[model samples]
Target chain A: MKQSITLGSVTRFIGLAGFLETIKNVFTGKLDKEDFKNIFRKVIMPLASVLLFFAVWYLSANKLHEIEADHLINKALVEQGPAEAEKLRACIASGDKSCQPNALPSPVQVWGAYQTLLADHYVISADKKAFKKKTASLNAKRIANGEKPITYTGRPSFVDQIFTSIITVFAGFLLALFIAVPIGIVIGLSHTLRSSVNWLIQIFKPVSPVVWFLLVFMIVKTFTKNSSSDSAFIICFISVGLCSMWATLVNTAMGVSSVDKDYINVAKVLKLGPMQKVFKVILPSSLPLIFTGLRITLSVAWMVLIAIELLAQSPGLGLFVWEEFQNGANDSNSKIIAAMFVIGLIGFMLDRIMLTIQKMVSFNKND
Target chain B: MSYLELKNIYKTYGEGDNTTEVLYNINLTIEEGEFVAIVGFTGSGKTTLVNLINGLLEPTKGEVLFKGEPIVGTSHERGVIFQNYSLLPWLTVGQNVYMAVKEAFPKKSKSELNTIVSEYVAMVNLSHAINKRPKELSGGMRQRVAVARALAMKPEMIIMDEPLGALDALTRVNLQDEILNIWGKEKRTALLITNDVDEGIYMADRIIPLRPGPNATLGPEFKIDIERPRDKTEMNDNPNFKKTRNAIIEYLMEIGNERKSEVQKEYILPDLAPKSFVW
Candidate 1:
């Protein structure tokens, strides 16, 4: 059904075409093998590496599940009650089949338990009859405990906790930004002010956020006789925000002040107004250092936030870990491990987001 | 009447224990549309004089007058091209030029400003690199961008501080011609500070050599009566050009030789216990 050229003919045609193209490119002085190599190395290799890493992770996860099941079985057997242990000992000594220890749950069994918990806590019941009965029972129990009947069905979920932490972080970060940047500008612009403020910044910069949180907690306690949990959280947030804002302020000011005098002279020659000079010349010139300071401030803020939460019992991922550690649940280790993983992932994502923003705003000519 | 005048200019650094004079009783006049090159050895206060006129630094005594009016500080009317290309690395060549154009013509339409910028950029033969930032450019290209930027403003006078001094020999020569071509067409007043006598003779209508210092002053001024669109090869052949170039070179050589002896004569050890009397 098809008319095909011989392999020799096709090869000859392609070779002739390639040779002509090469000749044309060479004459035009556009023969650039390096450009092609650069594209492959910078773009293609990185993408392939990422895909390969994920493939390895997926395969390993399956293998890890099997190992985890065996470990859990051994752990449960070791943790069996004294009565069960004695029975197992007697069974082994007397060679009897009657006194056997209960079999440990399999990986599927634990997964089923997790699913059941998710369903019970998360899924909304479609059956009105069952929902009404559950609500009535819950309300009766609250009333019997000398409290008003709790009608609200909404409960704070893990996702809600994440949102809370994000909102709090952003709020604190924005407040820090609003306060720090201008202060930094002023400090940076004036040598006298910078010298005077240097001591104050040095004193506060090294002080731990945990100490600040405690100090704030005490202040809040004195100010409000019965402080709400939100009050404590806010105090902690402010403590972390204020304590960690110094680096950004100092760096920004220094960056601004250290802008090359030549650039300023150029601005003067151009007769650029104050706003134009600041925004167009000074700020853009000092951006690399400013972004460096911002990255440091943001990461420091995260560290301080976690420290504050752990110390002050503030509601955040830090608090979640603290509470889980205190609860001593059977799977407390896993929960702690999971929360740590989440924290690290969130921190990494936050840094990546900041890096993206830095890339977006950076005006470095070479870049 | 001079287009620009410097009267009895004096500049001093420090006071009391550290008092030092840098410029003393300097007086000069430049005509309208004149290209004046101030030739000097390093630290001869040539840069200081230009800075004073540009109002970057104030003179201790005397005034700089432009159009018979006292110069106060930096203004859009006096554009300056620095030896080091001062184009903001953040901005592209066209953008850098456009910034000055926009500042000079704040109310002009965007299209009009854009056209002016492109024209100036093309004048410097940098239209191809218009969208490239300073770091993406070679030193010569960056200086060309700086030239484009300064010219785009259409200032009454452009002060260049050894603008082509940092370039390679060929690039320097090419840019010198390009600058002259642009200056001839625009006929704007320009003051250049350079150490090269040939460069001074090639570009300027007149060359003023500044004597060496503690108190450096302007020596003699040589009027270059050569016609424009000068061929470098032919100019070298001209008797007048040869005589002027030789005279400037001779004066500089004499000063240099005198300085060498003066240094030898003035040389003295610190009298530090006769080298510690090492036995």
Candidate 2:
């Protein structure tokens, strides 16, 4: 009974209690009134809210489309007279791509844009595969001659850009973790070091991602000038790292410094070596807080990634959004809206991933 | 020389004008294999005294000696069971004990270390919870893990700082007997710091009161003349137990009252008002 209770609490701590219960209920076919209420609140309510959101978005997009179309017709009437205005109206009524209003995309338009991007990805994948097959012999010959192999340099599809963004964000998050945690431990260990370094953290913490990007650009451009490696990718990840690391650094320092005095005493009484004390006692005690910091760092990194990628001209979702907006085609708005949803969804997923990891590592359930 | 000795120890916090002397002239000595308990009220710097002996904190004046050598730093020879349990939350009961045992016996084989961890954990009646983390355990269970961890190291001396103070009466008594049973077997030099007079009388050969602080000092020592293998229920019927208990409690109350009276000394506040700034 004790073993079961402990196991139950452990599962509950990781936030799998409700989820596991639902799964059990589903398999057992024993859904009661309480379970039904839970399912309604947890699943149905969120879906309803999302439907309401889509409805509002669709209505607003339709309103804007109508307004823009009206404005265009009025301008044509005044500038090109009734014949041209009538011609424009006829063209719009026929639903020609050229005369379509460029406004906020409706839900249907966004869905169409999503399908188009997916089709574009497939086409690009086929083109690349064919290109590789065609160049196989030539590439082998080039490699035999000790020359660089020919490669396909094509515009990345929406899916490719998304993968790029995700990769860059992960690289940035790792960089933040590596740089922040050790420095935080050192700073946390010594009051003098903490106080002296505090000014630097304070000054740098709130600095904008744009500024960090510019700073990284200067350094990376210099270093990678003669190299074949992607400098913009380096700049994007570095900037994202620098922008997001402050929270983790500060939190880690706080966590390390405020470790329970009792734990420290335990460390002392055990006569643990300095390294053992830190690794066994200090790190374990401070882990929950460090994880909290890491969670924040990841979200911040993800949030800043798009901006950095945009600034660095990295072929990512940020660049995709910016390019779509600049293109100003009839479907550009729809495509941008589609990208927006993808970005939001990915960010939410990233946060959940961090949360799950934090829960796994943290002993304090309340945290 | 005694197995553990604290000579003229003075522990103060802060510096210059802001300094507060927490413990003053804390002199104590426990012979080899002797069990001693220091009884003090809350905020009477009992932990400060414990820390001083455990080598976690250095005295402002004087020094602590263990086995006729001046102690410079912590050693596995002296195991401390803290009031808060202090079991690393991330480690399970078995692992917490394993960590301490490993530190104490770095050259021991892995299998040997595991045996020690399991043995000590079982001694605390926590074998069922060997795989459970501290956060998953009840307060009493967590304290038991702490005890197991401390004992697993096989320290020559055990220093307990109110190890059972946070437990309910039933758990407290259970743990007290468990600790005494272990102590009886090994006859290790032990120092227990607590506020409960009955606990002091029940566990130790000598009960010494720590006078209330701002400058806390060791008060008179009351010797427990009761024979070994002391029974808890029969202790109430014993004449010596009653006498010692009353003497310790009376001494504690007297000091407590003195401290309270000293605290109640009124200070005249200067007549002042916030100056209204003219616009």
Candidate 3:
């Protein structure tokens, strides 16, 4: 298949060459009919091969999909009750089946469920006074129907939870950045500091996020009696943030300290002020390394965030995944899979954000 | 009084049992606006001497006096052109020169400083590549930028530590002429450290050779009485230029031979393996 693609590319190049020649001849008042035939011969056969390669892929993709589908079907049968499982198997094998074996609740069903969830919470209720009156009437209606009274979770709304998680992550990252970069610079610049801190950094750098969680949990328990609030979220965030900060701190310090001594001499000879020396000379020279550190730190922070959420039951994508995992249902696997996809997408976006920032500050454009 | 004076300067590296002498009893003086070249074999402590004069390194004994006052640490007053063309790689040629100009005249407006930097860049005939970084420049062009940077500072004395040593022969001659032209216009006190005898004779008012070391000191001084605005081809034809070059070369060769034997003697060892106990 790859070979056919290469052949196809060669044909495309031949076609381009022929087109260029025809244009050249038209401008120069000269044309060769034989050249056109030769170009066609060179281009057409390869183009046919490329088409043939894609045809093979088109044929094979369905076969691969069937194998995957069969695997999923077998797994689903093991989990289902005998009557429903037999029905699903019969539906799948019948070939005229209207229902897709792999389909979770249809898009329409999920959308309907989402609307019901939102309406139950009175999310679009007119105002606080109106919402209170509407809630009271709804409660009465539910009681008359002999339905259970809805209890408030005492946590934020879903949207508010998202906002809280974002704000916490941003604040935690900023706090980590504030502590790490300067410490890295000091470690990088001074031999004594580097040696003294090396053992400590090495020990802490590879420690798992769970250790940070337990340690932070203890500290928070001792320091603040207020759990089941934003303080819990902050505490969880700090745990992940500190765990993620070590790599960047060490990398930054090494970067700064390892800047060429010649540059230091230039700074000294220029008689730059201490602030100017650090900001202009030292920082600019170490930017590539510093950015690299930042990139590693951000990715690690994202991974640690998930671990923190899972362990602490903090509200975020991590908690969403944990909640889905705990609530087993016919659609739970799909939800877990969907949540994993979102986590990966968010991590990718974070990396891209760091890359954009790196591009903005980098003095070397060629890099 | 000489513009710059080194009175019985002594430098030793390490201490106690491990102590090793690098430079010993070095005494020299340069008159105002005079270009003095110190020629030596490699490892004869020529760089150490330049470093001391520039106050990059302090001498173990004796004082380096600029005018009548004792020399302190590195300052803007003493500009150094290092052999490596120590222009920052990240900055363009114009920016590198502007950095020094900016430091020397912190109160100047941006446009004013830019104009000054451009003038120096033009002086080196590198105006076309003013915005090019050091990595983009040829070896010769980079060194020219280094020279312009030092000269633009308007220091009282310029200390060049083999500034053109890394360039090709043709480039070296071209940069040498450029350096001489700048020195002629400014008439700043200049000290050049080089190993090339002809270069020393061509560019300096006086050439002094540093004797080969464990403990190297200044050898005899040869004064180049040749006239200024020296054309390399024309200078080669002059009898006095030939005489001065030959004299400096002979002194360097004599010191080289002494160093050769010293190394040979130091390395020759006696075979002693406890006499292989024959019991």
Better of 2 and 3 by DockQ: 2
What's the CA RMSD of model 1 in angstroms? 10.5
Order the candidates by DockQ, highest first: 2, 1, 3
Candidate 3 on B163-219: residue-level lDDT in tens?
A: 988999999988898888888988888999998888988899999999977788999
TM-score, prediction 1:
0.75
**Local accuracy of candidate 2 as per-residue lDDT tens digits, B1-279:** 677788998989999999999998988889998999999889989988888888888899998888889988888888989999988888788888998998889999999999999999989998998998888899999999989988888889999999999999999999999999999999898999998889989999998988988799998788999998999999899999988888877887888788889889999999999999999
User: Which candidate model has the greater lDDT, 1 or 2?
Assistant: 2
**What would the TM-scores of all predictions be?**
0.75, 0.90, 0.74
Q: How many angstroms is residue A51 displaced in model 3 relative to the true structure, after the best TM-score fit?
A: 19
On the 0 to 100 scale, the lDDT of residue A228 in model 1 is: 48
Candidate 1 yields a Cα-based lDDT of: 0.78
Off by over 4 Å in 1: A1-160, A215-229, B266-279
* Order of models, best lDDT first: 2, 3, 1
Q: Model 3 reaches what TM-score against the true structure?
A: 0.74
Q: Itemize residue pairs with steric clashes in candidate 1.
A: none
Runs of candidate 2 with Cα error greater than 4 angstroms are: A1-45, B259-279
Question: Model 1's CAPRI class?
Answer: medium
